[model samples]
Target chain A: MRNIIIPAVLFILVITFVALNLFYITDNASRLDAILVSASDAAKNGDFEEATAEVERFKEEFSAVGKYLFAVIQHNEVDDVIFSSNRLLALCNADTKEQFLSEIEVTRESIKLIRDAEIPYLENIL
Target chain B: MAVAVIRTVILYIIIVFAVRVTGKRQIGQLSPTELVITLMLSELAVLPMEDMQKPLLAGVIPIFVLVIVEFFVSAVVLKSIRLRRILNGRPMPIIENGRINQQNMKKIKLSLDELAEELRILGSYDIETVSEAVMETNGQMSIVLKEDYEPLCKDNMKAKKEERKVPAVVISDGEIQKEGLLKAGIDKEQLKSILQKNGCSSAKEVFYMTSKAKNSYFIVKKEKKQ
Candidate 1:
C-alpha cells in the first residue's frame, strides 16, 4: 500500500509543478508576442522613438522570464530569441526600420515556437 | 551572467544535500531504484545550470521532489522488511554446503560460469571449498568459506602477541583535532608537553601526531619546506 501511495503522491506533485510552469510559460509568451507586434507596428509607422520604447518593453519582459524559459526549454532556442531581441534593439537605435521590422518578426516566431513546445499536444509530443 | 553563476553554485549545493539525504551508500552498493533516482536527479539539476534563461525554481522543484520521494521510500522500506524485500529483492543463496544451488542460480538468471567467476574474484577459487555463497540484492556475492578452508588467524593458531590498539591521529597538517585527542584520552597540556619533548613548540608546529597506546604518542615535526 505504501509503495503505491509514495510514488502516486510524487507523480501528482510532478504534474502540478509542470502545470504551473506551463501556465508561466504561456503568460510570458503572450506578453512577448504583444510587445513584438507593437514594436513592429511602431517601426512600420516610421516612429523610431516609439519603436525603441516598445523594444525596451520587450527586453524587460524577456529579462524577467528568459531564465524561466531556459529551465523548461533548450538553451539554443532561448539564446536565439535573446540574440534576435538584441539585434532588434540595435536596429531600432540605428533607425533601421526594415531590419527592425524583420527582427521583430523573427523574435515573434521564436516566442511562438517556445509557447507551442510547451502545449503538450499529441502532434508536438509525437 | 553573474546570476547564472550564482544559480549554478546554489544548485550544486542543493544536489549535494539531496544526495546526502539518500544515505551514505556507495554507487556500486546502490539498489536499482536508488540508481534510477540518482540518474534522474543529475539530469534534472543540469537544466537550470545549462540555460540561464531557465528559472532556478524549474530545476530546484523537480530535484526536491525526487529527493523527497527517495527519502520517503527509503524510510518506508526501513520500517517494513516485506516492502524492502519487494523493492530491492531478497538475496538468493547460490551455493549451499559447497554445492551450487542450480535452482537458485536459474531463478536469478545467473549462469554457472558467471557464478564461478564471481567466486574466484571473491578469493574463493575452489567452489568445493566454499560452504555457501549468497547473491546479494546489489548483485554482489557474499561467501562463507568451509571450516577447513578458512584462513589461519591469531585466534585460530592461539598465538600470544601484544594487543596493539588502533592508532588515532590527534593532529594532522599542523591542525589539532579535539575529537581525536578526546578519543585518544589525552588533554591539551599532555599534548603540549609531548610536542615540546619532540622538539615542537606548539600543535601548529607538528605536521602529524597519533596515539598508538596509553600515554604513548608519536609526533612528526613539520619540515621547513612544508
Candidate 2:
C-alpha cells in the first residue's frame, strides 16, 4: 500500500496539472468564443465595422479562438438570441476610447443578455 | 465572510450531488438533452454562490424542485407514451430515403444551406450521400449514411472493415445476461422466421457475446460443433 502511494501521488499530481492546464485553456477559449460570437452578432445585425474590430480584438486576445470560431459559429444556427449576445460580450470592447466610453455601458447590457443566452449553451462545452 | 465560505462549500456539495443525480452527463458527454441540462444547471448553480443575503434554503429549495420536476416528468414519460410525445417531441425526419424532407425542414425553420452546413460539421459532405437524417429531441441532428457511405461489407465503398464478429454469451462467470442471448441477432421465436441467420437460443450455452472493436458477434455455444 505504501509502495502504491508514490506513483499514485505522482499520477495525481500529473492529472491535476493537466486538469488545471485544461481549465486555463478552457477559460481562454470561452472568452475568445464570447468575443467572436459578439462579433458575429454585430456582423449579423449589420454592424460590420463593429464586427471587424471585435474579431481583431479577439484575434489579439485568443488567437486560436479568433482563428476558428467565426467559421464554426457561422455554421451553427444560434437558436437562442441571448446566447448570441453573450458571445458578443466576450468580444466587446470600446471601438475607440474617445468615441465610445458608452461601449462599456452597452457591453454591460450585452453581458446580461449574453449570460442569459450563452450560459444555457455553454453547459456541455465546459 | 464566514458565511460566504460556508455557502461556497455547501454550494459545491449541492452542485456535485445534483450533478450526480442528474447523471454522469455533467462531466462526460453532450447529447442534446444533456447539453440543455448543463446550461440550466450552471446558471442556477451560480445563484446560490451569488445570493449572500438569502439563506442556503433559498438556493437548495429550487434545486429540490428541479429534481422533483425531473422525476415527475420522467415518471410521466415512463407511464404515458402520449405524454412523452407531447413533452419531448418526436424525432423529426430531416431526410428520408435519400431525399430531404422540405416540409419538415420548413416546420423546424431549417434551410437547405443550414442542413448542408450541419452535415458538413458532422463529416458528411454531400446531402445525396445521406440515407436519413433526424433532428433529435434535444436539438441535435443524427444522420444515417447511404449504403455507399457506410463502412461495412462486400460493397466496399471504403476499405475500413468488412464486418465484425460479435460473441454470444453462454455463461458470464456462471450466470447469463438474457438480453445478451437475443441480441446475438439469432431468431428462434417463430417457425415462420427466416432460417440459419446468425443463430443462438440458450444462455447456459454461451460464454460471452462480445466482439473486438472490429469483429462480428462470435458466439461460443456450450456444446462444441461436431
Best by lDDT: 1
- Per-residue lDDT tens digits for candidate 1, residues B82-143, read 99999999999998988888999999999989988998999988889999999999888999
lDDT of each: 0.85, 0.58
| Superposition TM-score, candidate 2 onto the true structure | 0.42
Q: What is the lDDT of residue B69 in candidate 1?
A: 91
**DockQ, all models:** 0.04, 0.01
Per-prediction TM-score? 0.62, 0.42
CA shift of B116, model 1, Å: 4.6
Which regions of candidate 1 deviate over 4 angstroms? A1-126, B109-117, B154-166, B199-201, B220-226
Residue-level lDDT of model 1, residues A92-121, one tens digit each, is 889988877877888999999888867766
Docking class of 1: incorrect
Runs of candidate 2 with Cα error greater than 4 angstroms are: A1-126, B26-40, B154-226
**Chain A structural similarity (TM-score) per candidate?**
0.94, 0.45
Model 2 chain B — which ten-residue stretch has the worst lDDT? B187-196
- Give lDDT tens digits, candidate 2, residues A1-126: 579999989867865654554454446545755775676567556575787687567545644443333332322322232344344444444334322323333443433433332222322112
